[model samples]
Target: MVSSKIIDRELFERILEKKNSLDKARPLSAEIVQKLRQEMEIEWTYNSNAIEGNSLSYEETRRVVERGLTIGGKSLREHFEAINHVNAIRFIEKLVEKKQKITEQTILEIHSLIVKGIDGVREKGQYRSGTVFIGGAVFTPPPPIELKARMLDLIDFVNKNPDKLHVIELAAISHHKLVWIHPFVDGNGRTARILMNLLLMKKGFPPTVILNVDRQKYYRRLKEADRGKSKPFVDFVARNVERNLDLYLKAIKTGKDEQYISLQEATRHCDYSQEYLSLQARNGKLEAHKLGRNWFTTKKAIQAYLKKHATKNQKLKFIQ
Candidate 1:
């Protein structure tokens, strides 16, 4: 729904720069890629399900998905949601490896994997047969009778104009439009997210996971999209993708010792208090950024800042 003219050109260029840097670091060792993929499987599942109101914590989701352990006090549906989302991620990986095209059947297959054992067994891969309403949403989906044709049109539009927009924009718009269609009775949010990642992976970018912590902003952006102004939502998705690119690039470009750690953790290697380091980061004295209200900087960045400061202090002492 975002028109090209409305896109923030500066932000778009910044994401492309990050993405291009990622591509230059290509052919990451298979082992590293596999490890990152495994970690992402659990994290992506947890965040995606959490956004949809699933109560499983990050640790619980990891246990359920990895160990097949039944968590105490958690509903069977919650467990299924966790397991189904990982399975869906695996399915998407296979599709990416095969370089599959995006189509209605492909979308349904992904949805089927997502809702396999959940309450909507009968409607797992099927569109809605009746009206449905999104709670707290300002816009309503099209009537059930019009759903199929509209979905086909969406697919047709995507396939026809694959090169008309930036890849990130393409993925974000696909995500917004799918949510607008609201084809299925349930799992629409999760499925749209998976579809968005599918588009990203197809374009040779890493699959992005929108943190559950950003759910409020996420929904707010979607609501903005409903009002026929989609730049906000598109920018939201682009920021997520940028964050993901930063993560991947940091992992591959740096050695095992150069981790992107919290400021508090960075203090273990230095004599600065957490407050001081955070203040430095806030004032741009350190190369760091806030992720979810916490400042994160690499040891390399901190070391660089400290070395520069030490040199400056020595010069001042000599002058005295």
Candidate 2:
């Protein structure tokens, strides 16, 4: 059924062009790259765990992962989830650096890292021993007996079709298929997301963080994929990927200075509501464009607009 789904070639090419253009721009220094990776490591772990109902707040997750401090209200498992995810991220980074191939062994090892202390020793890194149902999901995962065969088949498909589909499509489909399998008793979503990033990183793309704000939409897209339509999920993933690329490109060009940002982000630096900003963007009063579904513009653009509109008695406020 996934094969039957139509690929949005136009959208895919558009995202690819943005990605390639960023790659062609000035190369980021190693220090800047590492700093960006560290920041994303925190965001990626926090968002991935939060989507799965982990009780740790983003700040709490940062404390647990970076500061190694325990939160007062969070359970040990929640803390472990945060810590383990960071370790798993580190593991994946090593795997990427080594240019490792995706295989059952790698998947299991990653799972092992993710559930090291949270799951039973027997369950850690092992496939589910029984059928699993996702609450409110439109489709159920395959039974345990079929998981191995299905996983192998999926791997074979990915390996054989490397040249058939674009890398983003390949990674997106792999993510959907992994979730459909629901290979482990726990951590399936987290593992699938990490693995998807693994594939993306392998292709020299940045890792995507599906923000907690988008959790509902993320699940909705996954459900759409389950019903044999993969485009929505693929498009969702691509948008996130595009957003990350935009951020990284902007950061590299601006050296952590004020740069292009989404309307929601821009609101923090200005007096305009997101709705007002959207209108301004639509009217071309602000130099911005709709990337995916959100409008993006630089701080300089906003500053210029303010200066042009400032009254003689009023001083223009710029983003600081």
Q: TM per model?
A: 0.79, 0.77
Residue 190 lDDT in model 1? 95
What are the lDDT figures for the candidates, one per model? 0.82, 0.80
Ten contiguous residues with the weakest lDDT in model 2: 1-10
Write the residue-wise lDDT of candidate 2 on 34-56 in tens digits: 76787788889889998989978
Worst 10-residue lDDT window for candidate 1 reads 311-320
Query: Largest TM-score belongs to which candidate?
Result: 1
TM-score, model 2 to reference: 0.77
Best by lDDT: 1
Off by over 4 Å in 2: 1-10, 119-121, 254-320
Error of 2 at 206 (Å): 0.6
